[model samples]
Target: MIFGNPGITYAATVEVEAESAILVDAETGKILFEKEADLTLPPASMTKMMTEYLVLEAIEEGEISWDTTTQISDYPYSISADPSFSGVGLTQNQDYTVRELYEAMAINSDNATTIALAELIAGSEGAFVKMMNKKAAELGLPDYQFVNSTGLSNSNLGENYPEGTEPNANNLLSARSAALLAYHLVNDYPEALEITSITTTEFDGQQIRNWNWMLPNMPGYLADYGYEGMDGLKTGWTDLAGYCFTGTAERDGQRFISVVMKTNSEEARFQETRKLLDYGFKQFEQKELFPAGYQIEGESEVPVAKGKEGTVEIEAAEDLTTPVKNGQEDMYEVKYNISKEHLDKDGNLTAPIKKGEKIGTVELVYNGEDNYKNLVTGKTQKTAVDLVTTSAVEKSNWFMLMVGGVGNFFSDIFTSAMDMVKGWF
Candidate 1:
């Protein structure tokens, strides 16, 4: 798609063959391009990202080890009809190691593998869903609700009722949630990449390939413009949702992710991600515009009361730079919005305020519009306040006294004495 006088958001206009998309800069966590990104669309096997996330988290906590082996319980297996599932065709009694199961899930997008991993780590898929939901909430992906380890619907498994008519614990997730899940997977679980980065693998004398068709294809039949460093991930198809893909790639040190759902065909899903990823990587370049410790040049002076220190120094959090293309830097500028609310009327120490405190934020503007470039990044830096001794306030410290400090302490003593004298009351 082409940019036609786009405004602050620079929102993409391209409608992919997929249902919705969210393309984010992996390194900076910036939304490079999006189409119906917030719209929750069903994610098929990509839901495995959550299953994958839970397994990795367990591994990190030392709750489970790669060498750990587990039983092929019918629980996670019944959710899949595909033979690649780790729990399926389980040699009917063989035990798979924790690491092996994770490999199955991440490298092969094996539904049964995911469930077996979850169960081995957390006792059961039901229990693991607790961990999954808890982790997603912690990561602030409130839009997602995981129902199971595999993306199978409980109702769909009725035909295979290995354990009888009871429903199987299937799973569900949205495209954006899955993208965040992938984001966490790539960034949080470095070990996972060891598997996802692999294009192909074989398990138990069975040759199974990665469902993520991005590798070995050179951005393959997807787009006229291709992305570089495209890695492995998951893909899914069902009668309800056409085809879905969740992919990640990197270029010039800037990593990005693309999530597409409900495409008309498997090829279409791949094509759309290629287009989004290509446009994203080619358009924006990462820049470390500001260092967190950078001390800004100037500060506006304010009134101050008598104190040991005549002036308190306040500095900007960092020097500022932004992500932009060639020749577009100077067109936009940032404005500081620090407020003097923390300062007293006399402009003296207010109980030793800390430096680098959230004194305020800065906003960036372009062409008379809020470029929304403030980035709203999380706490940039910690303030190392130089609490220099300053002269005491000349007037009565009523504020502190009111809070009943030393003065209150004495007043209470006096009051106690008076009450003693009137003890009868």
Candidate 2:
């Protein structure tokens, strides 16, 4: 049976200053707010989050180790020598450990170090770009295109653009896509935060600071933008991409991931992100709309055919809990879907149903105006719980089954005869 609640208030809305922006619950990937979130734009340095994910995955899979070292190729060496790009100077054919390069890339947004790590892992940057695109598809990112490891336009790489890519190409992602990438990075390899959270770390005896000023421990002038509960995330900018950031923070057992793209200035990215995160933390609360074993009133039972009992009761197999907007409890409703495979032709469950037997599922649907899609799957966020039988229903004995069959046969015959007589009249 279908049931619904009445009266839904519009979800509160907040304005953010950016071309594209999104906020999501880090744990559930449920989008809390979005504006032009699907508009594809250059991600700049935020592209490295994908690189970071692949590196951590390689390490976890035993393909490489933190101590693994690779020599600097001439391509990366030339890029490192240019001060215009973010990099640490590298000597030709000199060795550097994965740990060192990874820290520089994550903390300082070092383009050359990022490319070097990509080459080390995939034997070449071109191969690494392939891995990035493949992994994005695997992760269900809605919109993305990876042309280089550093998020730089291939024009910046000059003659060294990765093979099979356009020289004018730059990495692109929608805000939703960027948030999804960050979601997987943090959840899959949380250890990455250890390096990204560092405000400043010495690399080759030179101090390099993280680009994300929202981190809690910024020193000097950057301290002005510090935000509590903020941690390691990537920041980005280019002539084409404007300023962008993928930021994540945790407080009071809640974590939010935010992305702001094409903001006007270096500080605007963080400021816009602050708006997104604040809206999430201040306006929503963890709510259990329904508890486990919950059953809808007047619609909790399913008929059982040829069983000792006439019907079987069903209830939710697990709890339905998620972040809900404050004072918007009535905006949500539950829907039950019975499994056709478990029901007979007459819509009755077969005999001998076991207790807690898998039968159907109940899903939560949002009726408010600000309903949003999942960050990863790009589908409407409908959380579902399994429905199972509350108790077993034993099959009737042979005598009872025969009696029921006889009753059904006589009833059908009587109905047909009545219809025939009416037709003759």
Candidate 3:
């Protein structure tokens, strides 16, 4: 089945306070709302979403496992020891497992642990940077560049910067690209959420908390920003890139992924995200516009040639249900697209047609003044359902065909003679 944009006209009802922002339907990847979504900017630690994705992928491919062990290098050790950067203070001589480091990076935004995981997977941070960019391309991210695994400015790495990158470069992504990346992450590896949803955990005998304040059960003053249904995403901040967040929430079986870049403060990012999510949940609802086996009037049957029946009935193969804006149900119309391959030159199905045979497709078209396009593919994707034959059509007996042929031959001559006589008058 094909999925399309919601029938409601695309409009932003909420005032999102951010440099760039986007809201997407997690199930369909549809852009429900966007503002300057294509403008590329620093993603800061939010860049770790790509790293998290690659790590999950590696574990799935058997190249590594959560139990895989590796030691911290001098570069990461030095970075970890710094109080200014988010880290758990790893020592060079100690061994750490992938699961330990991944939790720190995902839940706490631990920069040093992120570098350790990158090195473990690719043998060097430089090689992991290459992998990140290649995967970004494979994922169809429209605007993105990966300079390092942890989303730190290369200059911050000092002389230890990844071998192939410029000294001062930072990771970059548009709001749309970040949203799409988050969409693929949660959908492709849903297990990742199990780790990301943890609000706090222990590392190296010290308590560390997730940087995403919107998560439930956040400790201390962070609890004021708690949002229901919010879970497992990343947040980022740097002098060059202001506060940014990629947040996901699920309520009433509907999930939405939202991105806000360059907000003024940590609290502001969550505040803006709340606005986006509220607009999504309150403004729309899951609706079944058409039921399975629904037949369209005047276009539900196909003529059958030389068969026992003159025509065969067709209906939708499945239900057409999707997120629809409240109070806009009448803005949708259906269009039938019969398959020419299944018909002869006279637009009739051939004899011996089987039951439930697919013969065409039906699409739902939005009649609203404005229609939204998909974030990945910039086109108005219409929802389509398969059209199938409801019953079988058998070939007529040869004797019956001969009798009909004789009747048609005399009837044609009599009609022609009558027309000629009338013309003489």
Candidate 4:
């Protein structure tokens, strides 16, 4: 289950044919949907995302400039020269600037251009693979390993490697890890989207077309496959990996990242991702439950035991934004549960509480099922959001409690006398 919803059943209903898939919110890190997302698989050309990330990060750190040019080495040239490989058509000893090479790698899925950039960043493809693995670990990816800067496996390596190096060092990534990689790629360096979105560009005197089929105006595929707001990401295909895509789109202020792996056909990858994007946009919306420092909707102020103030205000530590399904907004409920220890025997908050102190937790629930309903049940329930308060409830003095107690005492005595007179009559 993802985001506390039944993911497998939902994905099947949507006709997602991929072996592994996931859709996530770009900003909130919420998993909207997923199916077999943790299974490891070959990434094919989609591995270039890491290649693009390291290069862009280096540029950001002032370690390298965009205009810095590098000469095409023999290894990279061999890969590009082979007619069987997808490349930017680089010739040996030819020099291309960093930005030019990156554009080719990202938009065209050029293996040779990627290796050249990898070598420039880490001095060798093998060493760059090490960097990729290190960065993967830093990103908290649960399962991932990189054998090469390029996604090519040993059998596909052809004659492109130096002696004594492992040829089978191919890149492996799970759908979860791929989505996380894409998340960091767009969040940390949104500018990369600018390059990935390019439909066509000139490199080495030849026009290169982007491999991502989801973009509009891609010749034969545009009419059936194009989607708006799909500015970024990469596509991959190999005999072992099948068709895989990591796509991101933005509409209004929201952005989503989706990954589909091991689909039946190239077109199927983009089509499946489009279904996920549509589901994300149409079914749910980000709603602000409470603004920062605003009092929780139904919770009462705390009565302090020994403070100068009669009552202390209760408030959320920060803004609460939850993505709820359409037409199910009324089913959204916020519950504030405070521990018994934090309150006196009379159920009033105790004194000596600090501001922002967590006296309780805030829970958000949505009551619905596959077709959507307004009723809350054990089986169909989902938690849309959860937050812990550093100080949701405040401390107050005993004065307010004593005053309330005296009023209740007089009211109870009067009620008893009235009941006795009615019985005698």
The top-ranked prediction according to lDDT is: 2
For model 2 the local lDDT of residue 348 reads: 98
On residues 1-425, what C-alpha lDDT tens digit does candidate 2 reach at each position? 22344454554678999999999999888999989999999999999999999999999999999999988888998899998984778777667899999999999999989999999999899999999999999999989999999999999999999997999998999998999999999999999998999999998789988889999869988999998899969999999999999999999888899999999999899999888888999898778888999898888999999899999999999988788887677777787899999999999999899999989898887776665677766778879999999999999999999999999999999999999999999
Native-vs-model 1 lDDT? 0.61
lDDT of 2: 0.90
Q: Report the number of the highest-TM-score candidate.
A: 2
* TM-score per candidate, chains pooled: 0.72, 0.93, 0.91, 0.77
Q: How close is candidate 4 to the true structure, as a TM-score?
A: 0.77
Question: Which residue runs of candidate 2 sit more than 4 Å off their true CA positions?
Answer: 1-11, 414-425
lDDT winner, 1 or 2: 2
CA RMSD of all predictions: 9.9, 2.4, 3.6, 7.8
Residues 1-425 of candidate 1: C-alpha lDDT, one tens digit per residue: 11223233434335566668777666556665566665665676777777777777777788877788877866555554455343334443788787767777777677677767777777766677777778878776736756665665655545442232246444455656677777778888756666787765677777666667776543334333333587757777666656888888876677778888888887788888888777776667766444444333554332334332345554445544445543344444344455567556654445434344455554443442222211113222111222122223233355744554667688899999999989978
Candidate 2 TM-score, true structure as reference: 0.93
Tens digit of per-residue lDDT, candidate 3, span 186-291 = 9999888888889989888998889889998898998999988998688999889999999999888899999999999988999999999999899877778888
TM-score (C-alpha) between model 1 and the true structure: 0.72
TM-score winner, 1 or 3: 3
lDDT for residue 264 in candidate 4, whole number 0-100: 90
Residue 392 in model 2: lDDT: 99
Q: List model 4 lDDT by residue over 210-255, tens digit each.
A: 8887886666745467788898899998888999999999988898
Q: How accurate is candidate 4 locally (lDDT)?
A: 0.77
